[model samples]
Target chain A: MSTIALPHQERGASFWRLVELVGCYVLGLLWIMPLLYAVWMAIHPPEYEVRFDLFAPLTLDNFIAAWSAAPFARYFFNTFVLISVILVAQFVICTLAAYAFARYEFKGKTVIFMLILLQLMVMPEVLLVENYRTMVRLGLVDTVLAMGLPYMASAFGIFLLRQAFLTVPKELDDAARVEGAGSVGVLLRVYVPLARPVYVAYGLVSVSYHWNNLLWPLVITNSVSTRPLTVGLQVFASPDQGVQWSIISAAALMTSAPLLIAFLLFQRQFVQSFMRAGIK
Target chain B: MSKLSRLQSQATPWLLLLPAAVLLATFTHIPAVTTFINSFYTTPRGARPARFVGVEQYQSMLADPVFLAALKNNAIYALGTVPLAIGLSLLMAIIVNSSIRGRALLRMSFFLPTVLPMIAVANIWLFFYTPGYGLFDQILANFGFSSTNWLGSPNTALPSLMLLGIWKEAGFFMIFYLAALQQISPSLAEAAALEGASRWYYFRRIVFPLLMPTTLFVLVNALINSFRLIDHVIVMTRGGPDNASTLLLYYIYNTAFRFWDTAYASALTMVLLAALAAFSFIQFGILDRKVHYK
Candidate 1:
C-alpha cells in the first residue's frame, strides 16, 4: 500500500484510466453483441439477417410465424405451472427444514443437515438415469410433477433460508411464544415476516433457475403439454426444422422475454438477489 | 415448561424436517445410491431382468473410447473455462464497482447474459457460428480471412463452446465478486492512495488477498457448471464432428436416452459423482482454512 507513485506516474494513471474505461465499454458491447444481433435479426426480415442495414424495415412477422409454428402457448403454461409448483413447494419445504436447523437442537441434526447438503453436490441432474427410473416406477413420466419433483427439496434454498432465519434475533421468537403463539405461529409471525426479503431473493433465483432448466425436463416430458419453453425451443429449432434463423431467433427471444423483461425492469434487485443467493 | 411442551419441543424439529427429508431422500440420496448400485448390473433387456455383472460394466467403461474421450473433453472444458471465467468476472466486478461512467448500464450488459437461458444463448450463438454468413464470418471477412466452420469442424468445436461458456458465466460470477467487493472498506483504497501506492500495486497486494474467498467459491461453482454443461451441447453440436465436443454428462445423456444403454450411463454418472465428490472435498477441506466467516 505504500509504494511511491512518481511524478510521471500520475499522468500515466489518468491516461490508463481512460483506456480502461473504454476497454470496459468495448468488452460490455462484445458481451451483449449476440443478444443484440438476435434482436436485430428477429425483428427484421430474413434477407436482412446477415446483412445489417440501419434503414431496414422492422416487422413482427418472425414472431408471428414462430408463434403459429409451435404450441408455445401450451409450453408457456406448462413452464408457468412447473416453476410455480417447484417454487411453492421449495418455499414450504425449505422454510420448515431451515427453521428446524436454525432454531432447534435435535438428535442427528448435524448428520441430517450434512445428508441434505449432499444434494448441492450430487444434484438430480447428474443422477438422471436412476431418477428417470424412479419416475418410471412412480408412474410420473411425461407429467409436470416429474419435472418439479426432483428439485422441490432444494438444498440451496434450505441453506439460504437457514442463514436468513439465523440472523433473526431469538428474543423475537421468545416474545411471540410468551404471547401464546405456538411454534408454528411464532415462525409465521416473527421469522417469516422478517425473512421476507430472503424469500423474495430465494423466490426469484428459484424461478429463474427452473424456468431456464432444460435437461431434466427434456428427459422426463414426452409430450408437448408438459414440455417447458426450453425443451420446446430445442425441438422447434432442431435440425429437422431446416435452420430458419429468423423465426428461431424470434422464438428464442419470445421464450426468454418474460425473464429478460423482469431482469431489465428490476436489474438491481435481480443482481442483489443473485448475489445474496451466491454468498455462503 | 409443561411435560407436553417438552415432548412437543423434542418432536417439532423432526416434524418440520420431515417433508424435506422425504423429498431429498426420494430424489437426491436414493437416486445417488441407486445410480451407484445399478452401475454394477446389466441393462436388463426384456425378460432377462438385470443380473449382477459386478465390475464387468466398470471394465467396459474403462475400455470404451468415447467414455475416455468425453472424460478428456470434460477435463479440458473445466480447465479452460473455470480460470478464464473467474478472471473475467473479477475484472468485470472491478470495472463496475469503480467510479466509472454508466456503471449501471455496464453492469446490466455484463449481467444480462446470466438471466437468459443457456438454451437461448446457445440458439443465438448457433447463428453466430454458422458458416459463410454468420456474425463471426462477417467480421472476419472484413479482415479478409476465409470463413471457417466453427462448430462443424472437430478442431474448433470444443473451443467454440468454451468461448460461449465464458461469456454466459462471467457475469453470474461477477455478482459474487461485486458483493465481496462492497463488503471491503473504502478506506483501504483511500489509505493506499494517500500513501501514493500504485493502483496495481494496491490491488495486487491488498485487494486480491481480500477477494480470495469469493474466488474459491466461484471456482467451485464454475468447475461444477463445467461438468453440468449439456444444454449448449444439446442445442448446438450434439457432440458432433466425430464426438469432439462430447462432455461426460452429455455422453451420459446420450447413453441413457439415445442409445438406451442405462447400465453404461450409470457408470458414467458414477464418474461424474466422483468428480463432484472431489470438488466437495476441496470445498470443505481448503475452504474452511482460507475463507474467513465473519
Candidate 2:
C-alpha cells in the first residue's frame, strides 16, 4: 500500500528523520572514540601518547616495548590453550547431554533437566570459594586445566545444542538406524552435522568468554606460566608499575587483537551468528 | 527389541548424561552446597583445624563497613547502569533499525565493545581517566578545565566504572532489541502512519508493548551482569580509593583470596547467591508467562 501524505507531514517526518540520523552519527563516533584513542596512542611515540597531533610521526616502538615488558608470549599461549580446552570439552560434554535430552526417554528426566538448568542462574563463578577449595583438594590448582574445568560442561551450550538437535527430524534417526548406524553413529553423522551452525555460534561465544575471563583464573593461578592474558595485563598495568600510556595501550591492543581482528574481518558473520544464536 | 537391547536403551540416556552430570555436580551443585556450609565455619589457619562459627561470619558481614560499602556501591552501580543501559540500547536499536545512512557502520561501532575483553577495555579507560595527561583531561584542558582524578577519587570512581559498564553493555543489549525489532512487521509502522500517529506515539503505544518479552529478557540479563561484570573493577580500581568502586563480586574475591577469609567470603557469596536466586525466580516466572501467552 502507498503511504499518501500531505506535504507538511512529509516535511515534519523528514525533519525528525534528519535529527535522528545526526544523533546516531554523533553517538556512533562517541562510542568508538575509545578504540580510536587506543589506536592513536599505540601507534604514537611516548611524548605524543595523549596529544592529538595530526602529523605525529608514528613508530612501532610501543608494540616492541609492550612485548619486551612482560611475558606476553607465554600469556598468549596460555589464553589460547585455555579457550581451546574449554571449547573442546564443552562441545563433547554438551553434545552428549543434549542428544540424550532430545532423543531419550529416561527416568527422572524432568528432574535431571531442572537440576542442569540450575547452573544457568548459579554459575560456577559464584561458587568461587568452594570451587577453589575443590581445586586445591584435587591438586589441580595453578593448572590450566583448573582454569578450564569448571566451565567445560556449560548449561548454555547444552541448552543451545538441545534446541538444535530437537529440530533434526526423527526420520533421519530412523533412516540412519536402518542403514546399520548405531545410536552414536546417528548422532555423529546426523545430529552433530546438523547442529554445525549452533556449534559455530556457541564456539565463538564460549571462546570470547573464556578468553576474557579473569577473576577465577586470577584467584586460582599464582604463577606467570598459568596466567592468561587478562590477568597478566592486569598485573602489567597495576599502578605499582607506574603509568606509561603508549606501552600500556599497545599491550592492551596486543592482548585483544586476535578477537578484534576476527570481528573486523568477519563482522557480519560475528554479529549474525550472535543474532542467530538467540542468546537473549 | 531383545531384552539386552531394552536394557541398553534404559541405560543409554544415563550413560550419555554421566559426564555432564558429574561436571555440573562437581562444579555447580556441590560448590553451592559447600559454600553455604563453609559460611558457617571459621577459616582454618595453617596449623589449626576449622571450627564452627554458627552465623558469626554472617554477623561480622553485617558489621563490616567494607562489605556494607561494597553492597551499597553495588546498589548504586545497578541503579546507574541497568535502566540507562537498557534505555540507550533500545534507542540505539531503534536508530539502527530505521532506514538510516551507514547503518552497518553504526551497528559495528556499537557492537565492537561486546567482542573486546573487559580487562583490555578497562586498560583503555584507565588511560582516559588518568589525571593530567589522560585523554579525558586532554579534551577537558582544551576547554580550560582542570584535570580530575577519575579513578583515584572516591566521588568519581564508581561513576567512572558505571560509564564503562554502560559502554560495554549497551551495544550487547542492542543486539537483542534489534533482533526483536526485525521480527516486528512493517505493516505496524505503516498502519500507525496511516492513523497519523507520531513516531514517539507509535513507539510508545505499539512498538514498546510488542517488545515486552525482549525487554523482560534484557532486564534479567542486565540484573545478572550488574553483579557479574566486575572484571573492570578488578583491573581499573581494584575496589580502591577507600573501597569506593568495590562491587559485590570483587569484594567477595578480595575477602576470599586476598584476605584469606574464606568464611566471611562465603557469607558474602551467599548474599550474591540470594540476589541471583531472586532474579532467577522473577526471570523464570515472567518467561513462563510469556510462553503461556504465546
Candidate 3:
C-alpha cells in the first residue's frame, strides 16, 4: 500500500494539498475578519476606523468611553453573579440527578429522563412568554436569579454526567460503598472525581452558553441593576445610540473579553472540551 | 436485605432527584403546559379577564400576512443556512483534521465567532452592512461598484442575515465534524489511496458515508438553530424593510413583549414548539438508523 503509489501520486497529492492548505488559510482569514475588523476599529481612534494606515495612532479612550457610557461595572457584576449561581446550581442539581439516573433502578426513570431531555429541544427561551409569566408570578422578574433560574436544572449536564458515570467501573462504586459512604459521599468522592473531565467540559459549555445567551436575558431583565453584559451591550449598541462604531466595538469586545481571553489561554482545553461535549 | 433497607433504596433515588425534578417542573414542564393552555385564550387587558377563544389565534394566524411572511422567511432561512453551514463546517473539519500547517490558528479563527455573543456579532455586522460607509461597500467601491444598502433593502436583508447565520454556525458544527473525523481510522484512507482513489472521490464515497451520523446530528441542530436564533435579527434588522427578515421566533418575541399580546405569542410559540417537536422526531428517526448501523 505504501510503495504502490509512492512516487508520482505523492507529488500530485502534495500539489493538491498545497492548494487545499492555501484555500483553508484564505477561508480562515475570511472567517475571523469580523473579529479582526472589530479589534482594528476598537483600538484605533475614530478617525482611523476606516483608514488603512500602518502607523496609525492607537488609543484606549474608546474603552473608557464605552465603560462610562453604560453601567458596565454593574452589568459585569450582574453577569458574574448570574453565571456563577447558575453554574453552581447546575453542578449540584445535575450531579444529584445524574447520580440517581446512573446508579439507581428507580420506577419511571426512563419517562422522567425523556421529560428532562425535552428541555434540550424546547428551551425555556422558546417558551419566553410563559416563562416570563411564571417569573412574574414568582416575583423574580428583572432579577439576576430570573436570568439563571430556567437553566439551573440543565438536561445536557445531567445527560453528560450520567454517561460519564455509567462508564465508571462498578468495583469503584462497590469499594466506596464498602467504606460506609452515604449516597452523597459516594457521589462526591467516586462519581464526581472520576468525571472531572466531563465536569470541565460541561462547565466550559455552560459558562460560555449563559455568557453568550441574549434572548431570554434580554427579555427577562428590565433594569440596569440586573442586566447582564449581553443585554447591556445590546442596549448600548442599539440604533438609538447613534452609531459610534469605535465605541460600540470597544463595548462589544469588553463584554466578550473574559471568555475570549479564557478561550485563547486555554485554547487546547477549550477546543477539546467542546469536541468532547459535541461527541454525544 | 431487610424490607426497611429496600424501602430506603426506593426512596433514595427519588430524594436524589427531587431538586432537579422540582426546578425542571417549574421552569420547563409547567410553563410548556401553560404556553399550550394560553394559546387557546385571549390576552387579558385592563379590566378584562382572559377569555377562552379555542384556536381563534391559530385561525387568524393563517390569515396574518406577517405570520405568513415570517413562516416563509424562516423556511427560506433554514434552507439557506443549514446546508451551507453543514457543508462549510465539514470542509473546515477535513482541513483542520488533516496534518495541515498552522492548524491551531486556523481552528481558532474558524471557531472564534462562536464564542462572541450573537448580539455583539450583529452589532459588528451592522456596521459592515452600513451603506457607503461599511466594509462591504468599501470593498465593492474598490471595484468601481456603487454602494448598496445591504440590510435596509428587502431583497438583500434576509440573505444578508443568512450569510451571518452561516458564518456564525459553521464553526460550531465544525467541532462536531472534527470530533467525528478524529474517530475515523487511518487504515481506510491508506487503502483508498492505495487503490488510486482521488481525494475528492474518497471523500464523496468513503468519508461522507462514514460521516452520515455526524451530518444528521449537525442537521438537527442546524434546523433547530434556524428557528431559535433570532438574536442577530433582533440586533441587526429588527425584521426591518417591511418584515422581510422577520423570523418566527422574532415575530413571537414581538407579539409577546412589544405588543403585550401574550395569548397570540403563546399560539406562535406553539407553532415553533410543534416545529421543534417535528425536528426531534426526525432526530429519533436518525438515532434509530444509527443504532441499526451499530
Each model's iRMS:
3.3, 3.4, 3.2
Each predicted complex: what DockQ?
0.60, 0.56, 0.57
Q: Residues B1-294, candidate 3, lDDT per residue (tens digit)?
A: 999998998999999899999999998899889889998999999999999999899999999999999999999999999999999999888878876678899999999999888888889899999999999999999999999999999999999999999999999999999988888777878888778887667777777887888888899989999999899999999998899999999999999999999999999998999999999999896564663323
Quality of model 2 by C-alpha lDDT: 0.88
A152-172 per-residue lDDT for model 2 (tens digits): 989999999999999999999
Give the Cα error of residue B268 in candidate 3, in Å. 0.6
Clashing residue pairs found in predicted model 3: none
- Scored on chain A only, each candidate's TM-score is 0.96, 0.95, 0.95
Q: Ten consecutive residues with minimal summed lDDT in candidate 2 chain A?
A: A1-10
Worst 10-residue lDDT window, candidate 1 chain A: A1-10
Model 1 lDDT per residue over B1-294, tens place: 999979988999999999999999999888888888989999999888998989898899889989999999999999999999999999899888876788899899999888999999899899999898899998999999999999999999999999999999999999999999888777787787778877788888788888888888888888889998689999989998899999999999999999898988988899999999999888889775876634
**TM-score for each candidate, following the candidate numbering:** 0.97, 0.96, 0.97
Output the TM-score of candidate 3: 0.97
Using DockQ as the yardstick, the better of models 2 and 3 is 3
> What does candidate 2's lDDT look like per residue over B128-155, in tens digits?
8989878888889989999999999999
Q: Clashing residue pairs, candidate 1?
A: none
